[model samples]
Target chain A: MTKRITKEFADLQTEPPEDMKVDLITENDLFKWVVTINGPKDTPYAGGLFLVHVILPNEYPFKPPVINWKTKIYHPNVTNDGKGTMCLGFLRDGEWKPSSRMAAALEYVRQLMIEPVPDDAVDPAIAEEYKNNRKQFFKTAKQWTTTYAKP
Target chain B: MAYTEEELAQYERLSNDYVPDAEGPLVSPRQSSQRITSEYAQADPVYVHKTTTLPQQFSQYRTVKGDGNCGWRALAFGYFEALLQTADPSRVLGEVARLTSLNNVLDSVGYPRDIYEDFTDETLQLLKSTAATLPVHDDGAALLASFNDSGICNAIIMHFRLVTSAWMKTHADSYVHYTENQSIQDYCSTHIEPHAVEIDNLGLQACIDAIIKPAGIAVQVLYLDRSPGEEVNQLNWPAGPSTLNAPYNGLSTIRLLYRPGHYDILYKHEDIDILPAAAVTNPQINLMSGPVYLSSSNVCYSQQGLDIDNFYIPGLMSAGVSLAYSTDAYISNAIYAPSALPITSAATDPYSVPYSEPPKAIVESPTLEGPWNTDRFRPSQYQVEVKFRQVMPVRPEPCQTEAMKQAGESKAHFRNEDFQPQIWEPGAEYNVGRNSEPNRRRSS
Candidate 1:
């Protein structure tokens, strides 16, 4: 809807996808988008494509956007109950300034696909599972993505 | 964040002022001075550079020249050289390089001015005599168990800059205040205890910082308590926030402590039987002992104190018969001191450990925060400007017996006669001191 989001969407559309697809779930609303990201190369998550929903706020540039995996994802920050609330690590609660943007937040989630910050994470169960049983998390994430997001 | 063009230029100007010229004097005050310079005195120029001269050979002799604290430098070099002689051959070169640079502040000019004074020949002899037996190296732990003998073993983790940094961060508040206030006594009494705690807590990070970030030299943190165990405890061992995650030098720390009878520091090495004073072969305390103001012969002496005595006049000395005229320049120059270095001497890097060349500044490039914290490294920058200055002294009113009674120390009573020694006789005319009294006067 805004100039910055429009520009970001235009850029994402132009980039070629190796293992992921990013586009708006609802064609009329640009703020709610779907991103199907593949697991990083060589990681236990190899060949796994994970789908997530990204929700942009009304106060777009000032506040950070929220991204939740619609297709059951196992991560320290993401809850199993499907409540999309995730704490963005970069923004210190009392210390976060008004200048942080949405694009940066999205890019961090994209990076989370490759490496997970378990030390500074919130949900220990998922983090533990991700740590102790990496093969299982990759199998689950990939199966959910394939079953729920391929269309 | 970006700077405006004007702000950027201002930064450039400030940075440009810091680059030292190669041909300048070997010693000079690193900072500016204004009122401390009197019309009668002038400052000599000084220079700084790397020296190949081994410290052991120079232990017996000391150079009388330089601008700031020369005595401390001599002592630092003396002890370091002694350590090299006793230590394993592999540890010699690195320890020599480290100790030499650690005492860089002393090389700036005439420093530790208090010890430079012409005390009794006995004091001078004591200083020179004790040079041989002085312990110079603090015992260090081997970070890599297999690489024990090389100086780099424990030193790899014993980053002096970081240790100083931890000391500074832990005690920055008090040190800044005392040093800023120019009161060494205050620094000693008020700041030392808590300062020790800061070092204990942040030792690891401080060492890492010293080893890696060369430009940011660590502060010299001296501990009052001398037990290596106590020093280790005071250093707070595995310095914080990320302590458990990282293994620094095998077990993660080397402890420091003090040795008795001598006023120096010691460290315990794993194989060595004895720990000795390794850093300062001779520690000097610059203060007035008696009448003749003792200071380094080469350095300018700044005197301060109000001259209450109007002019050269007659006796407040004795209640005797028929006294004629007498002359004296009754001034208490003892209480005052000139700014030895710049008034602010601590700001310059307090200590510098040598690396072959200054480390190249790393450009900050954004990288995703990694899963684990990592320690960064940089080369040494020997260039430092001293800004630490002695605090002005405070003189309380002479507490008479009556005044002493009002306060709590009532047990040690004194009569008016006992208070006679405390009176301020305000003229130089009374040249004959109490010590030079005649036999009959003494008997009475």
Candidate 2:
């Protein structure tokens, strides 16, 4: 397992995704990863940095990693509570295949920032507001990004 | 009732997060397929009609859990089983060599060598190790043990998932039509690669093509649905044997009992010799689990349940029940006859209401087989626990054991062995001394 994990870690460090920087949370443990994803351009939260916690279960690769947004965001797919839990459709337990790549999962998270999946959202009310009232939703999202996600 | 926004989001989260709590072994011990017959006896008439005819063609089955990965697990277990059955180490070497060559496919299919090394290495190790233990005639026990261990089993199955994925990607033309609207690559990702998604027909076909066919193993899926039929619908890939030469001792085929959403391995008596260690410790598959093993035991534990269950043996009507008893295999299979009786005379309506008239089939005369020309159905003292009064036709009690003793005690020499004879031999020699006969032990 460490072989697979450290190999994945080495690959992530050497050639990280264009929008994301991934590193082990500490030098000692490989299970916890600290990730920083740049909000996509043209989106309301553009230029804002997002810190996400990626915790790989002991059954890594077999079981999926758990992700929580340490940096709050006003996206319908991400919960607005302090926990900020995010469940991308593919990352859900049933949908996560052992062959599913972490890089590809993060890409899905990145894509969600550009186009929130209002239909499959974690915060239904926020999703409703985003779908029915886009301009007002963008104003609050940008303000939240400025208040909470700015570096 | 409409849910509030908070409730709605919770519902969405719960649904997405829901993973079933899968029970039973990853791959279970092989069992009498008749357990399946008895399991469906009480269901609608169509199912009763189909499952009753199942064991006539397929005698045994090993259940793979209904867990999401059962399809992949079943195929993987079946492949290893076929290898072990080959009893030829070179088959393992050939598979290892073939799989190593498939590395070219895995790499070209866009999987990095590094990411897949763990799965590939694990798969190769098991194949090599299991074949090494062949001389012991472990009867696939070593293979079954490795499969039961989640760490080993999951890695091997993951290797299978990858091979299936890579196979589909490289050979897109044959599979392109089956992928529906999705590309072969995407279809493989969601269907073949996932640890949790059950295999659909295409995935079963691809895995069989990539791994099984090359090893010369046939795969048949018996669909046990309510489709109009006396038997389950069989789907065998490489319908006739493929170009790959059939191994001398290699499997005839790996049978899967596909009950719509799930897949379990089925074994014909012939398929089982190549599959599992004959019968292991689980005595539960006998009387406790279901009526499948109602094959033996005239000692009825439940006189009441006997009458009800006996009504459902559709196979009894196939050939005359008396005619069925003539076949030794059918006697043990009495096909779900827990409270089963051997009618001295064939009753026109054996399906008469349960517990009525003590169910006329129990032949009360000194011999149940007296009426039939075949002595195959003779009830002995061994089958005579008084608990079976209803099944034995209220025989005169004392004379029963005296006659049964000659039949039972003649061979009942091993005092310390199990109380019940492993396999009863009726009218075996009471004493075969040097003067009487020569010793002929069945030495393995």
Candidate 3:
């Protein structure tokens, strides 16, 4: 594989867009991706988008496969099936060894879409609307990205 | 408090007679059958391997205000020597020897710790919302009963230095003069009635609210003000005396360990005093001394999985993922101690359909009438048509093995009796006749 998708696409191009994001939804399946995040703009999802769907595991770079999120955005750190079932802190329990790469879970899910962490939400009602109605939870996540994403 | 059927069969025979391997069932060999893995070595195989085992029992409450002497064991030994000097002098000296043996069994059951300036602003927002729900491995009596169950009594370590500092300032007449002039029990008998009480109250906000209630972590206490050269205040840092003459030895001296939203780069490129006389960036005179608490717990053990990276140094990789749970519990107590066991075991299903169950029909064959039947009960179909005519072009001995080389072709190696429709009619009759030709030329 272009050596683990070119080092998680050169560490999603040297991290720091407040944290992470290794683009490429097309360029012929370096292993089916989509990415697009924003949220964590200081939270209550300051800008909110969060797309997600990376994939890659047919034994790529060996072992760790499964990164979800096809967009149905809400979190307790993800996992209520709008996909990107987010769970880092070591790509989640089994604690993902094999020196955990995917360019550090693509900069730990882009610093978890800029910290959508209400501790680690698996969706406690979007971690209690990002901990109690953060500006009408960013106006219902900008009206769920103009009604069901993919624009 | 449930477990009984002979204590869930002696905790399922001590959670299935030890299985962790990579040198862990506590130094292996308790008559080891190589620990377990012959498809989960039988008799009770439902998932569980390492076991975390919580509940060291809690429920012993007391938060009596001043004079009853509240220094929650010297403010939980000076907030675990300032959170073990911001991390990793050997994992904050083993969480400061597990919060100093659970604050010496709650200071021989006296329990009342120090500095509880009464409290209100809804008990200082329920002690900074239950110390932002503690739990990255809590034990110190559930972080002192989650700060005496939120209404916060004996304000242990001045309610975590007024909830990890930034000094809650919304002054609309100081939030109605500290909420209609103090009533969190007369504001802790009027401003912690002159400091000095029994401090060190162990129970780090109930181990950070059981690591934020099942990792649903929602900690958000933000305050920012008193700008200029960006706030590094630990009350003008520099204070070390007792606890073996403090200083790096008794830990807790850190002042500005950045990298969590880079605290607006020490308040936007440093420079303070934001009106009405403010101060706070004075860690022994403005910045520069580094290492005053910057241990973001190694980006929280890669968010707790442990592939390890980013330890600007706070308990370097959570003290190497908590001393890989006592050096190699097959990589952190067999993967973060059965997912930090609260009770998960339903046989660890997680989703349940992994190769569900339907596959036992291997080789039944009851209606076979022609592909070389040897006139009836298959005398091994004439040695499988002379071993498919001596392996026609010669390929399939499982494509020459190295464990089937890479597993392709699970079937079709040779079935082409010209695709099978001529049924041997032209050959059945002629074969019955030539069969006598000395067993077809003595099997060719």
Tens-digit per-residue lDDT, B266-373, candidate 1: 222311222221111111111212222211111122222322221001111110000000111111121111221121122343443332332321211112122111
Deviation from truth (RMSD, Å), model 2: 18.9
TM-score, model 1 to reference: 0.24
Q: After superposition, how far is residue A73 of candidate 1 from its true place, in Å?
A: 1.4
TM-score of each: 0.24, 0.68, 0.18
Cα lDDT tens digits for candidate 2, A3-116:
888878787888888689998889789999999988888988888999999999888888888889999999998887788888777777667877667787778888888899
Tens digit per residue, CA lDDT, model 3, A44-117: 44455656777776544323546787776544566664444665455642334322356657667667655667
Summarize candidate 3's per-residue lDDT along B1-444 as a digit string, tens digits: 775443553354345333343221101111211222232334232211200000011111122223212233223322432332222233233332233333333334232322122221223333222222221222233334444442233234333333311111211232224434554333322322222222111122222332111121122212122232222222222333323211232222212211112111011111111110111111221222221111111112213343112111222122222322232211211122222221112134332222222222111212212221122111121222232233223222222112222223222212333332222244333555544443344232
> DockQ score of candidate 1?
0.02
Worst lDDT run of 10 residues, candidate 2 chain B, spans B362-371
Candidates in order have lDDT scores of 0.33, 0.66, 0.33
TM-score of chain B of each: 0.18, 0.60, 0.20
Which candidate do you rate higher for DockQ, 2 or 3?
2
Q: List ranges where model 1 is wrong by over 4 Å.
A: A16-20, A91-103, A132-151, B1-444
DockQ score for candidate 3: 0.01
- Note the DockQ of each predicted structure: 0.02, 0.55, 0.01
